[model samples]
Target: MSNRVLMKGNEIIGEAAIRAGCKLFFGYPITPSTEIIEYLAKNLPKAGGTVLQAEDEIGAINMCYGAACTGTRVMTASSSPGISLKQEGISYCAAAELPVVLVNVNRTGPGLGGLGPTQSDYFQSTKGGGHGDYRLIVLAPSKAQELYDFTLEAFDLAEKYRNPVLILTDGFLGQMMEPVELKEKPTSPEVDKSWVVDGARGREKRIIASYSLTNEIGEANNLRWEAKFNGIKEKEQRWEEFYADDAEYLLVSYGTTGRISKSVVLNARKKGIKLGLIRPITLWPFPEKAFIPYKNKIKGIVTVELNTGQMIEDVKLAMDCCVPIYLYRRQGGMLPTETEILEFLEKQFKLSTEEV
Candidate 1:
């Protein structure tokens, strides 16, 4: 019997969260991302869950912060501007070491660009969009299947690290439809919840805080955060490679553009161009390991994006400037085409593009 069912990407995220035992969801309605909350509102109750449409994005994220402290699996969703509003609260969650999942159905933006697709949030997401010296476990899921799989993975990653996890997907993927097989729920490493404030009567008092009484304590707290980030860096960097093992040029991209970049690599191959792709699934732990093998082997690296080269910076950092890197992108929700990418590579790298 075929269990695969067609579903929208945004709704898949909500369904995955529910199956993962998420109890509370809080968010303000925003284009693209609005479908996530909408789906949850209508169906989460069937799983004994509660969905709250807060007054605004700010209220919603803060509500997540409050609920998470009680040892609850909490989440929220929003678009670019709405995510911008949730930044302060997000930073608070990171500092307090709360486990929560967040979804950003990216739209074009510096501010209210449109309900179009854009990966501009790459820099904002991976580089602490929230203030302070903290990092979210950023997962960039490329297609509808990933939108479901990574949402399940996001919750486990959040609880495993006792930190906030962000599922970074653009409007195009969120609004698109695809068939996905609902797999068995994933199992995560047990998190030590001794700090959870779920009635301290059973043990001693638990203070879940992001502050310190003295500067010395504050410095110590900051050091702890740095250590945790370093640990995550060493253990969590993840990426996907398409023919990068043997290629002269590599295309770097993630989310929807990542899937497009794959087609670019295939098309370039048909023309006898030695091209490949490296898609970073974990944007924060930035997948520096993936670039290490291709460092000196490839002539150069090309980054594709729906925004003005935000991820190019990370690609450069990953390659450490040892290998030349280039960027091809379009801003304000414009997606790049396979033809455009091939032309860029031929023009810039002077690669042989013999027509098959």
Candidate 2:
């Protein structure tokens, strides 16, 4: 029988990680994403895994770094503020080429933002959360099923690339409930300790350092990292598109906002609005090809974001302003409801009647 079950988004993330062969979870409790840690705390032990609640987000991510150095499948999750605290560790993870998974159930940012859904961290996550020439393999999930699937995918991508993979979500997606079918549990691959410091048996001590003193050596390392990122872009870009057959307008969004935008598109379709949606599953890669076909047909594009405006910039760059791209966003922890989006579309379409 399929392991299909109704679960909260956060719970599904933790459970799916276990099924994906994640054995170590280190995190501190935070709003929206705290359930992930709670779930792992109870279930990881039952699964013969380990879960540690560190003193703070910094400590939590550092613990993750330590566990990852031993070739353990490690993960850490937090909301916006906590994620900010973990940026230093994230940068270190990137520079050291450590395979790790990070989940950010984002809320409003730039300070002690409210514990409400917001996609304000788009730039922070996609452009690398900390200082350094690096990129996180960022995945954005619009539904609970995508959350579960992407958690598993994140583990594999992290190991395959030897880089950190971030599941960038929002508070709404994290707190929502939905039915999800857990994929078959992945077999844990035997750890290759050739590079890891696993007890240092019959091998020289391994160093997992991010710093290179020489400028030339650091530049060489950075170039190697860029080549890896290019490889990832060639192999890992992912996106979903719909209704471009004769669409005049395309909506670009991700995570919870993307799901809501899709609902708006469907509802507008019944009302004869020829609109389409491009959901970028991998936010960092930006799914540059997802909009190429619609470039000619797209008279205008609407970008719906939970933040004031972030991913819209990427959409604009991708489209090169060939089409009139409009931004519809709500910030300060407010969600853009379907009616609000439809109303915006009505204004854009210049509908004379109230049919919209």
Candidate 3:
């Protein structure tokens, strides 16, 4: 039976990972994301799991790499700057096709900006954050419930695709509390250890490095990685569409911004504004196909984000700029409030009516 409990987003994610059969977690304490590490440190061992707090983000991610190499479910959590330090390890995990789940509670950054929510890492995440030809299956959760649900789903997706999965969140979501229904715990799947070198018992030596110096070998490796990424795009583009029917304008957003946008859409509906939302759950393997059908029907899209305008670029690309794409954003620590969004929508309606 599912049980409901009020919890913070970071704690929910950590607990959900454990319920998803994740046996190992290694991470460094970072602002707005430290709750995840604290949760795991307190409860993982009681659940027959292991949790390690490394000296730094690099060490934490490498610890995850070692655990994942043994075909065990492993994870790490951090904010933007810490995530930056772990990029090299994330790339290696991707190249090695290891199933590791990473939670990035995004914060403003270029370097150690602050402990405030920011989606500035959109390009870094979707465009391959580290040096290599690979992609991470990135999931963006807007609510505490989604944080729980997506954390479990992330593990499944990571294992299914044999690639790293990233849960991209922001400080607002991490700090907020909400009721979440804990789902049934998943049973651990038997992993094939033929490729893993736990101790190299009676098998050829195993190498998991991404350094193939030969041009031919490197090209072949790239091709293989491309195939895997393509496969993911084909099978794993997840999104949520709300109040789309009879709507002339659509709002596109993710993470905490999406939650606020949902409220805006609801408020606009009361004023008879025809608007809807397309919330991308999987940021990577982006739901490009989802927007194709609505391209001609919708008047335009308003891209809402916490950063200045990162994901807006992706929305424009997905819609092919067929309709006018407007951006509504907040930066640093502040979130785009529902009142601000509704005001923006009212202005859009007036402007569009005048244009017509």
Against the true structure, whose lDDT is highest? 1
lDDT of 2 at 104: 96
- Tell me the tens digit of each residue's lDDT in model 3 across 1-356: 65999998899999998899889999989899999989989999998998888999999999988888888889999999999999999999998888899999999977888777788889888889999778999999988889998999888888877899999998889998999999885664665557676776777789777788899998998999899999999988999988877788999998888878889889777767888999999999899988988989989889888777888888889989999888888888787788788678668656343333
Candidate 1 structure quality by residue, lDDT tens digits, 267-319: 98888888999999999999999988888798998898888788899889889
TM-score each candidate: 0.97, 0.95, 0.95
Question: How accurate locally, in lDDT, is each candidate?
Answer: 0.90, 0.88, 0.87
Worst 10 residues of 2 by lDDT: 185-194
Query: Candidate 3, TM-score vs. the true structure?
Result: 0.95
Query: In model 1, where do residues sit more than 4 Å from their true spots?
Result: 354-356
Candidate of highest TM-score: 1
lDDT of 1: 0.90
lDDT of 1 at 35: 89
